[model samples]
Target: MNPKVTDYISSNIKWQKELEIIRNVLLELPLEEDIKWGIPAYIYKKKNIMGLSAFKNYCGLWFHHGCFLKDEINILINAQKDKTKGMRQMRFISVDEIDTDIVKQYVLEAMANSEAGLEVKPKKNTNPVVIPEELNIQFSKNEKLKYKFNEFTLSKQREFCEYILSAKREATKQSRIEKIIPMILNKIGLNDKYRNC
Candidate 1:
């Protein structure tokens, strides 16, 4: 275990024993420790394998490719109802909620799947728009907007694009574009604009 991660684990005692057990299972796998999404993440060859996190009422062991695994142990939970596939979470309400052996087997299987390059096929895009022509045109015409949009993080850009293109009607798309233009021109991300308000 990485010393930093060990220290992180040691700092929290609410579910110390349970966390320890889960840690042992994860450490046994050939994985590397890194910080991702502001939390301790385990990766195999650059692909995320799993992550450890704590919540107000529960702690979770997240398998990045959990949706791809044939979960006979029935350990997976659908955290989001709208998401059809790609990620799943196993939440533990308390120390006693953990099943060490079963969790270990799941961890092992997750690692094996990672090593084998297994992946859940991404959901196909169902939106009607074939990329926004306005986005390209607006971006090309405005150097400041282009710079700001480029400066925004990948997730932020994705959010903006998804929000704009998510509209089913042309009027809604135009309205979204109108709302987003100033935010982009000002070098502010979609969430940042809302957050500051």
Candidate 2:
């Protein structure tokens, strides 16, 4: 059990009771509980099986590989439509909506699927990394940074490239480039901080 998850559930004034009701069912599963993405997540074999979260309007469960579930109850919905590939959400508005027995059944099935090596592997990002003009200008100024950047895996290089391009204004792009120079030189990936959790 992670102390952070206690703070998470306790902090949600709107859905604390409802979340706790569902959490009781999740607790019965043979999974390790910890916090990931700053939310309560249950792990099986080091893979995230599900997570608990709260919003202003609702509290919900996030199934990490929910696409594989039979979902005969029709409770699962893709939270992000086309943008989200495999994750599905089962949202609840109140304590009355929870059915612990069904929840347990779903979790047991998900665990079985996970143990069977079922997964929705994301398509490979084959598109070439596009270096923004601002980044190119910076690279021209600091040749060593450019040299070091190429040493990284394509995914890492693309992360840095997109980081600069994602900023709307020129100043923001320049600042983002400046911010990442040290990281690039040190061979650090941009999202490294969140990756472990």
Candidate 3:
């Protein structure tokens, strides 16, 4: 067991036993175990295969390429139906909720899929990204900002645009623009803090 993952699972005061059972089951597989996003993640050839996470209500397994799994028993769930594409989660409310045999089958399938080089293709961004007027003006005024904004990936650009547009008032929009200008200049994504973790 990875010391970091052991510490993380042991620290789950609310679901220690549940987390430990999940951890032990995963350990029986061939994947390498490590800590990621403060959770126990199983990796195959440096690619994330599955991860264990504890939430307020449950501890769950996050299957990285779950979109590709056959899921013959129909247990895999799309945690975020619309936003999540490749990942799926199998949630457990308690240690008793875990069916070790079923879980093992799923893990083995996932490991096999990884070994077979199966993957879920990223969804293509088809719609044109919406750029708010506040950002448009900023881009027009500063060549560097314009260049930097253009340099961002389509998703990053969309995040910034959505953030600015979500503000209800002009002042709020302007405030958001001001706050994000440095981040744009630095080429950082709007949700980098959350995503990086």
Tell me the whole-model lDDT of each prediction, alpha carbons only. 0.77, 0.87, 0.88
Give the TM-score comparing model 2 with the true structure, all chains together.
0.88
Residue 42, candidate 1: how far off, in angstroms? 1.0
Worst 10 residues of 3 by lDDT: 188-197
1-197, model 1: which lDDT tens digit per residue? 67767766777778667677788777777779865665568888788888888776878788888877789878798787587466788889877788878887787788788788788767555554343776777778887777887777666777788887788998998899889988877877787734442
Question: Which candidate wins on TM-score?
Answer: 2
Any residue pairs clashing in model 1, and if so which? none
lDDT, candidate 1, residue 21?
A: 74
Candidate 2: clashing pairs of residues: none
Candidate 1, poorest ten consecutive residues by summed lDDT: 123-132
Query: By the TM-score metric, which is better: model 1 or model 2?
Result: 2
| Candidate 2 Cα errors over 4 Å, as ranges | 186-188
Q: Please provide, for model 2 over 86-147, each residue's C-alpha lDDT reduced to its tens digit, 9 standing for 90 to 100.
A: 89888888888888888888899899999999988889899999998887887899899899
Ranking by lDDT: 3, 2, 1
Clashes of each: 0, 0, 0
